[model samples]
Target: MRVLIVEDDAALAERLAALLGEAGLVAETVGDGREAAYLGCTEDYDAAVLDLGLPQLDGISVLRHWREAGRVFPVLILTGRGRWSDKLAGFGAGADDYLTKPFQHEEVVLRIKALLRRAGGHADPVLQAGDLSYDTFAGRFSLHGEPLALTAQEHRILAYLMHRKGAVVSRAEIGEHVYARDLEPDSNTVDVLVGRIRRKLPPGLLVTERGLGFRLVSEPEFRD
Candidate 1:
């Protein structure tokens, strides 16, 4: 999943990005709230970690603007204020959850996971495709009930693909969802990752459309 972190604290934003990355999620940060708001509305992110205090534009207004524009992705408000009014305003403005600052990092991760599950219409965190089953919270992929070993990059690619199952995802689209903004899309890393997935997954799990992109098939192929 790709997440947008809106916070002016450079250190804190980077720390959050790293934490999300380690959890098999892609993240990008914007120190300015206006740019953050622009990206939140323009780009596709599974969720966001938005701070109440921000320069250029306050986080609350940003959230309100997104709601006004009908952008429905789940957003978790992060702020130092723990008052009831603060939380009420956040939810009233369309936030799915709230988190206080100086909080445990794992708490933020957990909240995001909940939002992802609810947003995807998944009653449980487990996602299944054919012979593959993935634990969204555990970030593990299993085939035929046996856990499959995958590199971090492979895991992220597969998770994103599973979420968009049946849709053709281009190389650029995959790169955008799986890697941070700093990573170059021109690199062959994406191709290599897909190749590795083909090797790891059951045959026919993934198929490529020349000049189109790639899609995930939930049914395994049988040989005659």
Candidate 2:
């Protein structure tokens, strides 16, 4: 999964990024809330870890702005505040989950996974696309009961596609979800990844539209 960390403390931000990366997630860190707000509104991140005290703009204000603008990605507030009113205010400001400072790294990762599970509409923790099954929290995939190993990027792409199954997702849409604010690589990156995914899939599942984009063909019959 892809995550954005909005924190001002350089050391803490780097630590969080490294921990998240070790847990098989693509993570990006920004130091200020203005940049956080802009990236949060434009990019397609699965979840965000935000600190309440941020420069340029407070994290609560950033959350309010994104909520007002109808941005729906799950957000987890990580701050030093530990009072009841602060927790209430964080939730009131649209945070899906809250974590206080001096927390266990494992707990933070677990909380983020829980928030993502709730947000993705897969309340059971397992995402299913016909006979294929993927455990969102565990980051494991299986086809017809056999385990399938996938690269981190492949897992992210497949999870995003499966979350929006039946929709015709354009290459640009996939790119935005995979790489947030990072400059676009060549145009064929999406195609190359899709090709790799197709080779791993059983017989006929993923479908490509002639001049459009790609879709996961869930029906029994396949389409070109």
Every model's Cα RMSD, please?
2.4, 2.0
Candidate with top lDDT is: 1
How many residue-pair clashes does candidate 1 contain?
0
Provide the TM-score for each candidate, comma-separated: 0.87, 0.89
Query: In angstroms, how far off is 56's CA in candidate 1?
Result: 2.5
lDDT of 2 by residue, 1-224 (tens): 67899999999888888887766677899999999999888877888999999999999999998899898889999999999899999999999999998898677777887787777566777877777887766778898889987887777778777766777888887877666457444549889988899889875677787688888766534655
Error of 2 at 176 (Å): 0.5
C-alpha RMSD (angstroms) for model 1: 2.4
- Model 1's alpha-carbon lDDT is 0.86
TM-score of 1: 0.87
Q: Taking the tens digit of each residue's C-alpha lDDT, what string does model 1 give over 152-185?
A: 8888889888877777899988877777767746
CA lDDT, candidate 1, residue 121:
71
- Pick the TM-score winner: 2
Model 2 regions lying over 4 Å from their true place: 217-220
- Cα lDDT over the full model 2: 0.82
